[model samples]
Target: MEIIEKAPAKINLGLDALYKRQDGYHELEMIMASVDLADRLTFELLPKNEIVIETDSSFLPVDRRNHVYQAAELLKDTFQLTQGVKIYIEKRIPVAAGLAGGSSDCAAALRGLNRLWNLGLSLAELAELGSKIGSDVPYCIHGGTAFVTGRGEKIDFLPSMPQCWVVLVKPKMSVSTSSIFGSLSFNSIQHPDIRGLKQAIEADDYLLMTEKIGNALESVTIKRHPVVQQIKDRMMKYGADAALMSGSGPTVFALCEKKTRAQRIYNGLKGFCDEVYIVRTLK
Candidate 1:
């Protein structure tokens, strides 16, 4: 049997790190939403108990360390399934771009395997399993707009965000999430108005949403990679309603009210960046 899934990239509308926990994870409050840009996953059943991964991208590891393979193993162990599976990932989303490519791929694998193996796991159960894979995996398991807290494992469903064009730019460099967290000086950080952002979204106040847009990690990322700041500046100058770095360091996204303006910004940044995508908010 073959099962296909769409693994969409995620954008953090608001992300703040409150404190580092004893478990080596940080406490965070973030608002995440899916974008139209996605990676495709195709699963094929195997005769033996093995997890195989194939991807066009030469950069990503295909071994057991790969999140997709890990997801298959987790499901097999959890359910005691005898079947093996082969996963093919069409990698459109940039690797390590802070777009949750790996996490989404893992989520896709979990969802695909459930269908392929006749495991009637609920979405909540799948998300619970996903959390064991990665913090972002749980949210990606049930893709949509959400308010995430508690090391990004806890999710609260939010109303669909107002439709808009998102211009995403990924520079030719990858930033390590661990290094960013290690470099962060929590004392100097300014907390974003996460509550205000949530209320604005609830009320459908686009203007207030744009005004309140902020990420506490921006300063930490910008200091390390000035290109991120430059991207944000250029996007704002080119008429984005709000521009912020999505997750940790590199990939920056600009929210535009109009598609044409987003296209303009995308075209303008193409020369400066290796990867640039213009996509609509999935919600």
Candidate 2:
């Protein structure tokens, strides 16, 4: 039997870092939402006892270095499954674009394997397992909109934010997430209003949501890569209702309630950036 999963890319509507924890990870509060842009994964049973990954992307590893391979390995080890499986990734999301593409693929692998093996794991259980893979995996497993806290493991499901078209612009260069975090100076941090953003989504107030959208990491990333700021400025100039960096560094997404405005942003960005996409929230 074969199972397929759609791993949608996630965008951070709002992200704030409260402080560095004793464990050396930042205590974070964020509003995360899934976008229609996604990568597709196909899982097929293998006769031998091994996990194999195949993907169109030349840069991605098929070995344990890949998140999909890691997910399959974790499940195989935990469940002591004798059967093997092959996973083929139809990559759509850009690599290392701050879009949580890898994490989403990891989540998809976990979900797909559960069905393929008849493991009968609940989403909560899968999400619990996902924590071992990456911070974004849990939220990606539950996909939609959520208020995330505690370094991104804690998820509080929220009603879908007011629907809007999302225009994403990815710079050709990828920024290192670890490097971005390392350069963060707590004293200079400008925290985004994560709670207000959450509340705005809860109230279904699109205008307020646009106003509240911000990212604490934006300035840190902008300092290193000015192109990110340039993309944001262009997005707003093209008629986006609001614009913000999705996660850490490179990809910036703009929200527009109207399709025409979104199209304008998309059209404007096409010539400016090599990678641009216009999509909607997954809800």
Candidate 3:
């Protein structure tokens, strides 16, 4: 039997760092929504008791480092199951793009393996297991709009974001999240208004929502890759209502209510970025 799962990419509308905890993890409050861009995973049961992974992207490793492989191994070990599975991933989202592509793939793997192995785990259970894999994996399990807090483990469900088009532009290069967060000077930077963003989402205020789109980590990544700031500026010039660097950097997203305007921005970014996608926010 074969099982297929969709692992959608997520963009942060608002992300702020609260403080560094003794646990060594920085506290974060973020608003994120899934986009139409996604990675496809196909899982097939195997008779051999070993995990196997295959993907379209040569850049991705098929070994234990791959989250899809890790997810299968995790389930197998936790349940003491002897069954093995082969996972094939069709990569659509760019790697290390700060769009939760890998985390979503891990979440999809967990969900697929649960069914493939006849392990009837609830979504909550799967999300709990996901948190062990990565901070963003839990959010990917229940793809939609959500307010994530507490190092990305605590999730508060939110209403669907107001209808809008998203133009995601990924530069040829990728930014390391650890490098950005490691050297972050939180005291020197300004934080986004998390409360205001929450209010805008509650009221379904599209204009306010667009205005409030911000990411604290963007500055750190912008410093490393000046191209990020250039992308944001170019998106505005191309007719985006508001633009922000999603999550860390490199991948900048522009929000536009008009399809024509979004198309214009997408076309404009295509000249600058190798990977540009015009995707609708899942509402």
Local accuracy of candidate 2 as per-residue lDDT tens digits, 1-283: 8899999999999988888889888899989999999999999999999888999999798898999999999998999999999999999999998999999999999999999999999999999999998989999999999999997899999999899899999999998887888788999999887778888999999999999999999999999899999999999999999999988969999999999999999999999998999998988
User: What is the C-alpha lDDT profile of model 1 across 212-244, one tens digit per residue?
Assistant: 878888889899899999999999888888899
Ranking by lDDT: 2, 3, 1
lDDT of each: 0.90, 0.93, 0.92
lDDT per residue for candidate 3 within 147-221, as digits (tens), equals 999989899999988889999999989888877888789678779988898889889999999888889998888
- The TM-score between candidate 1 and the true structure equals 0.98
Give each model a TM-score.
0.98, 0.99, 0.99
Worst ten in a row by lDDT for model 3? 181-190
Superposing every Cα of model 2 onto the true structure, what RMSD results?
0.8
Off by over 4 Å in 1: none
Model 2 weakest 10-residue run by lDDT: 175-184
**lDDT score, candidate 1:** 0.90
RMSD of each predicted structure = 0.9, 0.8, 0.8
